[model samples]
Target: EEVTEGEEVERKEHLKTQWARLEAVVGTKARITLIARDLVKHFENRLAALDGKAMVVCMSRRICVELYHEIAKLRPAWAAEADGEGRMKIVMTGSATDPLDWQPHIRNKLRREALAQRFRDPGNPFQIAIVRDMWLTGFDAPSLHTLYVDKPMRGHGLMQAIARVNRVFKD
Candidate 1:
């Protein structure tokens, strides 16, 4: 699907609006932003605060490149933080390939310290790109409270997705 430049912009705008609505219902301190090209900045500024804090970066295979690039930039800084004691930590889940398995341009591969994941069911799932990813369901991160969603999603998936940020933390 060759979505024209115009179409992609429209989709981003639409997602931004929806996110504003989801923000109200999501718990305090929890937020979702629709950052098109600035995904890296958002991650460094918002998600980075959780670095070395025991968290999961759940996202679709499609955007993993952007995620990877961003994390690569921040690795040095986090390496100093001392995760869970004396280690730097970051857990990512996605298929062995790319996040957007549909896009041939986005090639996924094992890079640096990041690990890959393959959800049991493949194409059988109703693919609503805006929402498909491994970090969405049944995943827990006690230190996770804010989620930055750069993609789209709806219905049960939407609810379960952000809910990943709801786990309680101690001290």
Candidate 2:
């Protein structure tokens, strides 16, 4: 059957408009966990993709120290371990140290490694930290919900963190 030219144009225009509307509403980061100052606009949109659930966080060491102090003393449990239930673990991935004071960079790496080992069973830990490292894009874990970033990231690095929580799970 011969197709009408006007009908084709009209259909194409309708589809284009619909696509634009859908994108405007969802954006890029919708339905994933977020790590930022506010949870209003970007974070909330991402949360929609998640359908609102719990997630684990792999945090950096320096930031973890501060977070640790607050969570332990301020509102929730004091110990890093969750009491009588599954607790989030911190896998602060880092390297070794030389002379303990020979190089500032070396010292920093040591700190990160120390933090990663803190959790012991990082594969299953709910909370973890990674200073000077990235794990969200490639690493897969069921409970990894939140990504508390305290480092500078842009371009592909940003995309990885957003992908971390979009993974569909049965739990």
Question: Per-residue lDDT tens digits of candidate 2, residues 1-171?
Answer: 011223577787775666456534432232222332232334346656653323223223444333433343432432344222233323343456433321222324454344334333334322433333434456554444555554444567667766775655545
Off by over 4 Å in 2: 1-60, 75-78, 81-86, 94-134
Worst 10 residues of 1 by lDDT: 119-128
Backbone clashes (count) for model 1: 5
- Candidate 1 residue-wise lDDT at 19: 56
lDDT of each: 0.38, 0.40
RMSD to native, candidate 2:
15.4
| TM-scores, one per candidate | 0.39, 0.40
lDDT of 1 by residue, 23-108 (tens): 43441222222232253455456644553122233233333433333443544343222212212223333444534533332223
Model 1 scores a TM of: 0.39
lDDT for 153 in candidate 2 is 49
